[model samples]
Target: MAVTRIAAAAAHFGRDLDHDLGRIGKLISDARAEGAALLVLPDAAIGGYLADLRHPDPEALPPALKPDDPIFEHIGALAGDMVVCVGFCEAEGNDRYNAAVCLTGAGVLGRHRKVHLPAAEGIVYRAGDSFAAFDTPVGRIGMLIDYDKTFPESARTLALDGAQVVACLSAWPASITNAAPKMSQDRQSRLFDLYDCARAAENQIVVVSSNQTGAAGGMRFLGQAKVVGPAGNVLARTWAKAGLAVAELDVAGEIAAARRVLRHLDELRPESYRVSR
Candidate 1:
C-alpha cells in the first residue's frame, strides 16, 4: 500500500484575481514542500464568496471566469506535479456557476459545479445537476461544495461512482442570523465538522474539507479545515484559524480495511427508500 500525503487549507482570499493567484501559489508551494500529493483549497478561493449569504447584493457578486481561463493556467503551472482542487466562479457563456476543479500541471482532471444551493446562493449562481467521481494521481476522487455536504445523497452518489476520497471546499460562514459568541461555537462550525465526519463514515471514504478563513465583505467565515478517515476519525484539523490540515495514509488499504465487514455502498436498499417529488 502506498501512503499519500494530502493537505486541506483554511485561508483567506478575496476578489483581486492577481492577489488570489499569488496566495494560491504560496499555498501550493507550502503543500508541495510538505510532500502533499493533493491540496484542497477553500471555495471561492479565486474571486471570493458572496458578501452576505442571507441577503446578497447583486452588484457585489464574485467576478466570473471561464472554465479554461488563464487564471487556471497559472494555477496549473504553479501546481506542477501536485494535484490541487480550488473553487472559483465559473463563466460558461452567459451563465455563471460556483464550481471547483481538480487539476494538475497537465490540465483539469475533473470539475464539479455545486449541485445544492443554499439561502441566497441561487440568486447568483446556477445549480449543478449531477455527482461524479474521477481518477487522479492520488486516487479516485470526488468534490462537493459547501451546502452540498449537508445532503447525504451528494456524497453517497460519489461513493457509488467509486470515489475513494471526497474533497469538500467551502466559503462557509458563521451563523448569519444568529452569530455565536465565539467562532468555534458557531452553529455552522458544528454543522461543518459534523457533516464532514458523517459523510466520510457513512460513505466509507476519506473526506478532505477546506474552508475560507477570516472575514470577507460582511460575512465572517468559520475556518475548520479537516481530514477525516473512513471511521469518522479526524486525522488532522484547523479550527477557526488560517492553516493547513495534513495527513498521510494508504488510501486503498484504509478503504479496504474499513469495508472488510460492512460495505455500505453495496448493501443499500434503494427501492425501499422513497422521496417525494
Candidate 2:
C-alpha cells in the first residue's frame, strides 16, 4: 500500500481563536482537495502556542480548546477520507497540556501530550508522562512535539513501541539578535538534520516534521518542513513558503531503506544497560 502524505507549516499567527482556527480549517481543506490522505499541520494550528501568554484558565478554556471539545466533531465531519495530525493546547482534568491530536476518517485515533517543554512554556503547561504510538490505516505513527525531537531517547522509545513514522509538530523560531549576526536559521536547520537522520537511521522509520512560519510576537519562524525516508534521505520537503508538499511512501521504499542500512534493533543488550530510576 502506498501512503499519501502532505505537510505544511501554520506560518501565520492570527489575533484570536476564530481567525486562527478559520485559517487552519482552510489549510486542511486545501490539503485534502490536493489528494493527500494524511495532512500534518504546524504546532498549535488553532491557537498560537506560546505567542499569547494570557491563556485561559484550564477550566475556563473554550470547549474547542478542551480535549473533549465538541469541535472535534466538526473536524471529524470535515476529515473526509484523510487523516489529520495537528498541534494544539488540550485540557484534561484540572491540568492544561501541550498536545497533538490525531484524527482520521474513522474518528479520533489518539492524542499525545508533549512530554518535554521548553523552560519558557513550562510555566503555563504541565509536562506529559507517557510516550506511545498510534495505528492508522496508513501504518503505525508516532508523535513528538517540538523540543522532544532533540532528545534521541524520546524517538527511540517510540521506535521501540513499533512506530513506523515519527513526526514532530513545532513552532520553531529563528535566531535572536546578536551584535555580529543571527544564527537561528542555521541552528534550526542543523537540529532538523540531526533529528531526522538519527531517528530514521537508528530506528529504520520514516521521519516527518512540520514547523511554523511567519512572525509571532518578537520571534520569526523558519518555516521549513520535510518528509524523510528511513535511510535519512529527503523524500519531499517544503521551503519557507506556507505551502504543502505531498509524497508517497511505498513498502518497497521503506523496506529498501531499512535493509540498505540493515538495522540492529534485535541485537541490543538492554540487560547490561539498565538504569536505577
Candidate 3:
C-alpha cells in the first residue's frame, strides 16, 4: 500500500461552537503542515463534553446538531484533500447521540455513534448499537468515541470488519474519585494509553488516539494523544499537553509484517471461547 502521514490531536474545546470551530481550523492547518493524510480530532470537538460526569446538567448539555449540519460542511471544506475524523453530538428528534464522522474535501465517508456509555453519558446521549468500518482515501478506517475504547470488543469488531486504522476520540477526564496531583501519575492517564496500545496490538492495526486537554467544568482532561503501531508500540506521542502526535506509516505494510508469524485475528478461537452479552 501507500505510506500515509496521520495525526492525532490533543486540544481543548468548550461550549462556544464558533471558538471550537476556530480551534479545529488551527489543528487542521497544523496537520496539513506535517503533510498528514488523515487527522483524528478529540471527542466533542464541535460542542465539548459534559461538565460533570456523575451529575450532568441536561440544561447545559452540548449543543446537538443534525448529522448533515452545515458545520460538517465547513469541516469538509477545510479538510479539502485530507481525511478527518471528528467527534460531535448528534441531534435526532428528541434523542441525542455522541458521535464521530469521517470526511474529506468531497464529503463524508462514514460515521459512528458511540455505543458504550459510562454511567453519566446515558443520561444525556442515546447509545449506538453497532460498529462498522468504511473505506476512505486513507484506508478502511473505523472510529471509537471516548468510553467506547474501554471495551476490547469495540475495536475488535471494527478489526473484524476490516479496518486498517482505528481512531479513538476521547474527551476523557482524570479520575473523579482518586485525583493524582501529577498528570503523569493519574490513574485514567495510564488506562488511556494502555487501551490504545492493547487495541492496536490485539487487532494488529494502527491506532490513532486523540484526546482533549485542559479542564472543562469540574473535569480535567488528560492530553496523551498518540499513534500506536500494530505491535503496540507508540510511534509518536504528545504526552500531557496540547499538540499533535504525527506519524508516517505504511498501514498495509506494517500490518502484514506484524501478522506474518502470529496472525491474531486469523487464529481466533471464537467457538472455544465463551461469548459474553
Candidate 4:
C-alpha cells in the first residue's frame, strides 16, 4: 500500500460564493504544495452554511447550487491532482439538500446528500436516502455531512461498501443550548472527536474530518479538523482555529494491521440485530 498524505481544513466561510471559491482555491494550492493526495474542506465551504442552524429562516437560506453547476468546475480546476471533498447546499427544483461532493481535476468522483438532519435543519433541507462509497485516485472514498457522522450506521455503511477513507465535512457548531466557557470544553466539541475516533476504530478505516470555525450568524463553530487512524489514534488535529490538519498514512496497511486480530466488520451479526422503531 502507498502512503497517502491527506489534509482536513477548519476555516470560516460565509454567504459570498466568489469569496468562498477564492479561499478554497488558496487552500487547495497550499495542500498541493504540501503534497497532499486528498484535501477535505468544511461543510458548506462552497457558499457558506446557515447562520442559525437551530432556527434558520426559510427565506434567508444559504445560496444553493446544482450538482453540475460551473462552480464545481471551478473547484475542479483548482484541484489539480489532489482529490477534494467539499460541502454545499444543493438546489434541486424546489427542494434543497445538505450535500457534499468528492472531485478531482478530472471531474466529480462521487456525491452524498446528508441523510441525517439535526434540530431545525430538518425544517430547511430535505434529507438524503442512502450511503455509498466511490473510487478515487487515492483510494475508495465516501462522504458524510454534519449531523450524518453522529450516527454509526452512516459511516458503517460506507465502510461496508469498501470505503477506505471517509471524509466528513461539517458546519457543526458549538453547543447551541448550553454555551461552554471555552470552545474546547463544549459538549459538541467532545462528541465531534469521540465520533470521529469511534467510527474509524470500529470500521478500521481512515477518517478525514473538517468543520467551520468562527461565527456565522449567531452560531459559533468548533473548528477541530482532524485525521484519525484505523487504530483510533488522532494522527493530526487542529484546535479551535482556522488551520489544516495533515497526516501521511499507508491506508491499506493500516486497515490490515487494525483488523488483523479483531475484524469488527467481518464479525458483525446483522441478522440478529433489530430496531424496534
Candidate 5:
C-alpha cells in the first residue's frame, strides 16, 4: 500500500491535555490534507517527556502527576483512517513507564515500553524490557522510544517480526550542535543517522524517526526527524523544525532488492551470531 510519513516537532506539552491533543489534532489534519498515511510524533508528545519536565528529585512531582487524564481518549479519537504513533508517559499504579503507543485505523493496536533508558532516565521513569511489533493497516510497524534507538538489536527484533518500517519517537538533547566549536555535535548526528540508515539498508526495510524540538524545562531538544528508504537513501528530512516529512516506501521493492543484493536472509548464520548467557 502507498503511505506517507508525517513528522511533527512542536511545542512542549501543557497541563491542559485537551489543548495538547487539539494541537496534535491540527497536525494530523494537516498531514491528512497532504495525504499522509502515518503520523509519527515526538517522544512524550502528549505530556512532555516527563523526565525532562520532572525535577532531579523525584519528590518534586505531585501525587497524581500521571494517570489516565483524558489524553488517551483524545488521542484514541484522533485515530481513524491514518495510523498515529506517539511517545508518552505511561502510569501504571505507583510506577511510570517511558512508552510509545500505536494508534492505527483499528484503535490502539500496540505499545512498546522503552527498554534502554538513558543515564538520568532511571531517576524518574521505570524501564521496560519488551521488544515487539504490531500489524498496521498499511503494513507491520515497530516502535522504539528514544534511547532504545541506539541499539541494533531492537530494530533486528522488529525486522524479524516482519515489520516493514520501524518508527522511533525521541526527545534527544541538542548538545549535538552544528556550531564550528561543537564538531562533536555533527558527529552525534551522524552517528544516529548512520545507525538508522544501516538498520534500514541491512534489514531491507524503512526507518522513520520523529524527535522533539525547542527547549522544555532546562533541556534543549534536538529535532532531526527523517525517513530512510530501504536502500539507505534519505527519502525525506526535517532540519530541526516543527514540520512534517512525507515519503512513500516500496515494500515489494525492498523485499525484492534485499533478496537480490545481500541475500543475508538466506544465509543462515544464526548459530554464529547467537550470544551465550
Candidate 6:
C-alpha cells in the first residue's frame, strides 16, 4: 500500500521521430523531477497520430516502428528507475497497428495494440483482438489506445484480468465535422473527460490518461490529460493545455477503500449480459 506518484502528459508530437523523442525525454525528466514513479506519455508519442481522422492520406501517416527497435532501449535508458508507458504506430510485416508499450530500464514489460477503430481509422491501421493486464515494477497494469477507452467492455476486460491501474494513451482530437469555436464547447472534449472518469469509476481502478495537443493537419487535438482515482474524482489534470497532470496515491489502498462498500467487479452477473458474436 505504498503511495505512488503518477504523471500523465499532454503534448504535441509530429511526424519527426527525433523531435518527438526529444520532447518525450523532456517529459520523462520533468515527471522524474516531480518524483513520479509512473509516467504515461500521450498516444503517438513516438511518431504522431493521423493528420486527418476522416480522410487521412496514406502517404502522410505516422512512421511505424518495430517492437524491437533500438529507440525503445533509448527510451528505457531514459526511464531509468521509473515505469513509463508510451504509444506509437506499429509495423508488423505489411500491416500496421496503433499500439502502446510499457517499459522501464529493464526493457518492455507489456504491450497492447488498439482494439477499437473509429471511422476511417481502419483504413490506415489494423485492429487488435484482445485486452490484457501485465505485471510491472509499479503494479499490475493494462493499456488502452485512443478509441479503445470509448467502450466499457475494453476497460472491463482489463479489470477482469487483474489490472490495478489502466494507462489510457490517446491522440484524441476535437470534433472534426462539428467543430466548436471554444475548446470547452467541443463535443469531443466532453466525451473524452466523460470516458476517462466513467471508465475509472466503473472499474474502480486508477486511470492515468494522456492526449495530444496542437493541430496535425486539419485535426486539432484535445489535451485534457489527467489522473483519475478509483472513485472517479480527477486528482489532477492539465485541462486544455500541454503539460503534465501529476498525482500521488496508494494504488492498492485507494482501490481497497473504493471497493469495500460495493465491489463492482465481484458483483458482476455475467449470465445477464447479452452480447453478439
* Candidate 3 lDDT over residue span 1-277, tens digit each: 6899999999999999999999999999999999999999999999999999999997999999999899999999999999999999999999999999999989999999999999688989899999999999989999999999999999999999999999999999999989998878899999999999999999999999999999988899999999999999999999989999999989999999999999999999999989689
Candidate 5 residue-wise lDDT, 83-120, digit = tens: 88877778788887888788854567778889998766
TM-score of each: 0.98, 0.86, 0.98, 0.98, 0.86, 0.98
lDDT per residue (tens digit) for residues 34-83 in model 6: 99999999999999999888898989999989999999999999999899
Model 5, 36: alpha-carbon shift in Å?
0.8
CA RMSD, predictions in order: 1.0, 3.4, 1.1, 0.9, 3.3, 1.0
The C-alpha stretches of model 5 lying farther than 4 A from their native spots are 1-16, 50-55, 59-69, 176-184, 274-277
Model 5 residue 241 CA deviation in Å: 1.4
CA lDDT scores, all candidates in order:
0.94, 0.72, 0.96, 0.92, 0.71, 0.96
lDDT of 5: 0.71
> TM-score of the candidate numbered 6?
0.98
- Decide which is better by lDDT, 3 or 4: 3
In candidate 4, which residue ranges exceed 4 Å CA deviation? none
Q: Once model 4 is optimally superposed onto the true structure by TM-score, how far is the C-alpha of residue 73 displaced, in angstroms?
A: 0.6
**Residue-level lDDT tens digits of model 2 in 213-233:** 887666667677887777777
Over 4 Å off, model 2: 1-3, 8-10, 52-64, 177-185, 251-253, 272-277
Those runs of model 3 whose alpha carbons end farther than 4 Å from true positions after fitting are 275-277
